[model samples]
Target: MKKNILGLLIVSLLLVFVAVNLLTGNEAAPASSLEIQQAESKVEEETVKVNTEVNAEIPYAKDFTLSNLQGEEVSLSDYKGQIVILNFWATWCPPCKEEMPHMQSFYEKQDDIEIVAVNLTSMDVGLEKVKQFVDDYGLTFPVLLDEEDIVGQQYGIITIPTTYIIDQEGRVFQEIVGAVDEQMLEEMINALKSYDE
Candidate 1:
C-alpha cells in the first residue's frame, strides 16, 4: 500500500508540472502580441503629431528668385500682391503627375492666382525632359527649374509633391503634402480671398 501511494504522488507531480508550463506558454504568446500592437499604435500617433507640428510651424511663404524654363529670372517678390501657388514636384513622381491637371484647372479658373511649379534639380535628366513633360501634360502655367535646388532648400522641403498656398500678403496660408484635389485648392483660395477682404 505504501509503494502504491508513493507512485500515485509521483504521477500527480508530473501532471501538475506539465499543466503549469502549458498555461504560462499560452499567456506569453498573447502578451507578446499585445506588446507588438501597442508599439505600432505609438509609432502611428507620433508620426501624426510630428506632421501636424511641422505644418503649423511652417505656415508662411518665403521669397525666392529662380530661373524659369525659358531661362528668365522669376522672383516671389514679383507676385507679392497676388495669391501664389508654389508647388515643388519631381517629374518621376506619380502623385505629382496626378496633381498637375488639377492645378492647371485651378489656374485656368482663377485670374488672380499665380501658379508656379518648381522642378527640383536633376542631373540624371535635362531641361528637354521637363519641357516635354510640361508640353505633354498641357500645363500652361510657368514651370520653373530649380537647377541648384536653392529654393527647395530654403523652403525646408524634405519631400516631393509639396504645395504651398501663399496669400497676397506673402504669408503661407496652407502647406499640402502629396496630391490634393481641385476642391481643396478652391477652398484654400476662397479662405484667402475672405481674409484679404
Candidate 2:
C-alpha cells in the first residue's frame, strides 16, 4: 500500500511540473508576439502621421540673399526661376541635426530645387562647430552663415530650423516653424513647381 501511495505522489508532482511549464511557456510566447505586433503597429501609425503632415500646405514663405560658406555672395533673386527652400538652423540644436540629413537627401534628389541652410548667428554655437557639422553630414546644400543675425531677424525667426519655401515669382509660398521631413520638403518643391507651370 505504501509503494502505491509513493508512486501516485511521484506522478502527481510530475504532472504539476508539466502543467506549470506549459502554462508559463505558452503565456510567454503570446506576450512576445503581441509585443512585436504592437511595435509594428506603432511604426505604421507614426509613418501615417508624418505623411499626413507632409501633405499639408505651408504658410508665409519668403525670400532673402545671403553669403555661402565659401564667403561668396548668393541671392535668392538669382534663383528667381527655381523653387527655393530656405532653412534656418543652429549647430547645437538637436532638431536641426535630426533634419539635416533629410534636407541633404532632398537636395541631392532634386535638380531644380535650391536649398539654403542658413546658420543662425545669435546663438553662441561657433563657426567651427557649424563647419564640422556640415562636413560630418555631407551636406551639399549652400550653407550660409548669418553672422549678424540679420537674415534671421528679417524672417522673424524665433526658433531654430525655421524653413521658408519661396516660389519662382519671388514670393513666400510656405513657412515651416521646425524641422521638416523629406516628404514635406518634396511636397513643397512640387507645389512650387506647379506654381511655375
Candidate 3:
C-alpha cells in the first residue's frame, strides 16, 4: 500500500513538472526522446510540495527537543521564525545517504530555512559511527541524535528518510517519505518563503 502511494506521488510530481514547463513556455520546441527524459528527471529532481495535491495525511508537527552532535540541546520551537526541515533518518539507510548531500546543499544555500537532521540513534550503530558518517559526508547542518527514539515515536516515523517541512508557524506543510534532492529542497523552501512574504 505504501509502495503504491509512493509510486503515485512520483507520477503526480512528473505531471506537475510537465504542467509547469508548459505554462512557463520552458519546454523544448519539439519533444524528442531526450527531451522527454530530461523533463521527467528535471521534475523529479526539483520535487513537488505535497499534502494539498494528493491529500497526504500528515499530523501537525509537534515540538520536541533533542541533542545535537556537539551535545547542545535543541528544540523544534527554537526555529519558530524560520522554515524547518525536520528529517528523520538513519546512517544505515542507503537512500538517506544519497539524499543527505542534497540536504546539506540546501541547508548551506538557504539562510531562511533550517535543516535539522534527526538521527535514529537507537537504530544506528553508535554515536561514533554517526560522527564518522557526518564527517565523511561533510554535513554542516545540525545532526541531532534521537538517543531514546522518543521523538521518532512521537512523529510516527516508521520509515527512514521521512521528512517534515514545517512552516514558520511550526505547521507541517509537507511530509516527504523518501529521499529528497537539492532542487526539490530549493523549490519547497522558495514556495514556502513566497507564502510568508
Q: How does model 1 fare in lDDT?
A: 0.81
Number of the predicted model whose lDDT against the real structure is largest: 3
CA deviation > 4 Å runs, candidate 3: 1-59
For candidate 2, the per-residue lDDT at 149 reads 84
Mind giving the per-residue lDDT tens digits that candidate 3 earns over 1-197? Answer: 99999999999999999999999998657789998999997776555634323234535579999999999999999999788999999989999999998998778877787899999998899999999999999999888899999999999999889998898888787788989888777777776666656
Please rank every candidate by TM-score, starting with the best: 3, 1, 2
Candidate with better lDDT, 1 vs 2 = 1
**In candidate 1, what are the lDDT values of residues 1-197, reduced to their tens digit?**
99999999999999999899998885544458788899998995675444333233445577888898888999988899888999999888889889999999989998889998999965317788888889988999988888888888898788779998887878887787888669778877776676566
**Considering lDDT, where higher is better, how would the candidates rank from best to worst?**
3, 1, 2
lDDT tens digits, residues 62-179, model 2? 4567778788998767788777888899988899989999998888988887898889955747888888899999999889888898888888889888888877666677777878
Q: Give the alpha-carbon lDDT of every model.
A: 0.81, 0.79, 0.85
Which pairs of residues collide in candidate 1? 60-172, 61-172
